[model samples]
Target chain A: MKKVGIVTGGTTKFTKTDISIESLLVSAIKQIFDNSSNLSQKDVDVVLTSTNANNKYLANITSELSGMAPKIAHSVESLCNSGTNCIVSAYAYISSGLADVALVAGAEKTDSPGLVLDWDKSRGQYKHPIYWSSMFTSAHKRKFGTTLEDLAYVGANNHRNALDTPYAYFEKPFSVEEIMESKPLTENLRLLDCSMPCNGSAAILLASENVIKNFCEQPIWMTGIGQKAISASFTKNDDLTSMKSTILSASDAYKMSKKAAEDIDAAELHDAFSICEIIELEDLGLVPKGEGGSYVRRLYDTKDRKINPRGGLIGTGHPLGATGIAQTIEICQQLQGKAGKRQIDGAKTGLIHNMSAAATSSTVLILES
Target chain B: MNKFEQELRNGNFVCGECSKCNKLVWPPSDLCNNCFNNVKWRPISKIAKLVEFSSKNDEYFCIAEFENQIRVMGKVENILNLHVGQTLTLVKCGFDGKEIFVFGLGD
Candidate 1:
């Protein structure tokens, strides 16, 4: 297999507002290329792009960009997983020798006002597995005795994590007590737990060994990659509390990397909701099931492990298409031991896991120094 | 809230029950998640619990937990910071001259 290395990466801020996703994406790409001496717009072998926007202008903007070679310029959409899956496809291209270097980028300007994007019709049809399994969350709340306050722990933890992150949209610190006393949405979920739409783009350079030699001397290696996508129907699965896709994807990545969950130093999981991060920790086997909550509690009480040190989507923002790539950028920083204020401290191996809405499609990646 | 056009109103807000695998899903899906086969749509009890949650108010926007079934969580609603064991149900009401179903304290 060809060796793949992430030469450099970047992320925009996490905030609440509307912005042109296409423009933000272009600017993000430009920033990455501008920062790198080895990478010009010319070195980008192919461009893997993801977004949730339906703007007509975005298509035009992409077509005019640099480095997207003719016939190689492709777009991949797994809705929210687009950002992360872009990294997966880019690695595949470089490792398979199809390309020497690739630019996997995700960007969304969901904060752009009056953008009436709708996918709820698909939810009724169960078109995606996440909505398939997760939408029931509404009715599930009705059947079970669980309260929305239980979900507050997740939001409170994420907000606290954001307090240390400069790029985080909400910089205030929150506690579980504060979160529980807040407000409610859909019973068990809170506004703080849900990710606000953001206006930003994240781009990463995936290069082969040869390409890395031309880029930077100290590039982070793309250590392992794995993905799985089944329909969103939770009825077909044996378990209801966790994600089959998340478990399977992480397992595949671990197997490919010859690493175990314990070997990872830090991580970033999709936190579309605060509970999402808590459950994903267990689903990815970072902690035992039912133990994830306790683990998060301890992490908050003591501040160890530093999961989602970048504030995740809940504290930062979730711009759909930009989320996966943004997480990758965060992972690269951790693996390089350069997260600055949010550094994982001696982190050598890092992991990233993401989903496409309500846990339908999921991707897991392993990166190392 | 004249949401007469809302799809959840026209349909039962389906869930899935796979006899083949004996698994259950809410807002039902087409295939059995376990058996990977076609499943039957089952009407849910609609009354769920609030197992997990968070709360926040960022000036103009707001969020809090309500309740749901096992593991995964539902959306945020216009309530207060609820305890871990609060009970609730999906309720239909009129808000600002609009008819809608919102999660509220259950009896």
Candidate 2:
């Protein structure tokens, strides 16, 4: 298999304004062309679109709109991690000698049908994401003594980090007190603790090591990738305190990359809710189990941007399909020293964690400069 | 509607049990996940143990496990104190586009 590297990427501002999925996708794609001086319509060999909208032939449509006639074109949808899933598909194409240059684009509308997993009958009347999140919170609180204040700190820190991210949906920062005082969605959840669904798009260009120099000067190599799907049903996650999929996926990712959690200079965690970040920190081996709350609180107090520096899904606004790609882009920028305000200095390695469907499925990627 | 949804709409909670492996296939599949053999539909027990719970607008929602395998999220009623591992009875259940479960403390 050939080495695959991210060549260039672009993103559109995440917002709640009504926008066509195709339009949002094109806006992000146009940035790739604008960013890469050598990139042209004829250079793209594959076009993969990640989205949850019911639109048909989206990859072909976006390919034409972007003036590309790739040999391979299709769509990939895996709920919140669709963007990275599509990128992985492109990586496969490039690594297998099937394609050299692949363009991956992801977009989501505010009212995307992907928000709710209607197929999980186990969720029953409590099908909304908050219910599962609440369950995770409740269990974490019961077992680890995680408190509402700890949950609030996750929100406040992420929102504070988002203040520096231009493309993030949230512009203003919220105090811990403000987040704690927000409208209660459940006994363990608050409105501020949740990630808002919004309209957004992100795109990335990938190239094998052979032709990467043509598209980018300092390409970020995709060193490790791991994905796991235990079950689609929410009830399958018996251990509510931790995300089983995330733990398993991260283990594989670390093993594949030959790097431990300490080597990861920064990471973009899938904080769909506050409890998610706390659990992911432990599950990913970045922190000890049951110590995630204190770790995050310490990060918050010290103004550290080591985790979710670009603002995680909670602060960045979850566009579902576009989120993973946006996260990958942030890591790429951080590694390249292009991330202005939120850049973790001298970061040589980065990680991306994206999950879907109540933590039943997860994808972890390790990237290096 | 499949057997599970059909039975649920009729106020019956049923799960797919494999005849060969005797393993309960959750989410109601046509084939057993363990043996790939055909499954038989049967009613699930109403006695469930609380797994986790949280309240929304004064209405309690929780995950209840039955038969030590099948688990689901539903509404809890007539119980002031909720704790994990507490036994509860499935008082009423129905499927109205979405599955609805009402659990109460056992008398």
Backbone clash pairs for candidate 2 read none
TM-score of each: 0.73, 0.99
lDDT of 1 by residue, A59-123 (tens): 33564765354336767767778877878888888888988888766777754321221333322
What TM-scores does chain A show, candidate by candidate in order?
0.88, 0.99
Q: Tens-digit lDDT track for model 2 on A225-318?
A: 9999999999999799999999999999999889999999999999999999999999999999999999999999999999999879889999
- The model with the greatest DockQ is 2
Could you tell me how far off, in angstroms, the CA of residue A63 lies in candidate 2 after the best superposition? 0.3
- After superposition of all CA atoms, the RMSD between model 2 and the true structure is 0.9
True contacts kept of each: 0.02, 0.94
RMSD (CA, Å), each prediction: 7.6, 0.9
Task: For residue A144, give model 1's deviation from the true position in Å.
Answer: 12
lDDT of 1 by residue, B78-107 (tens): 556655456656554222222123455656
Where does model 2 exceed 4 Å of error?
A: none
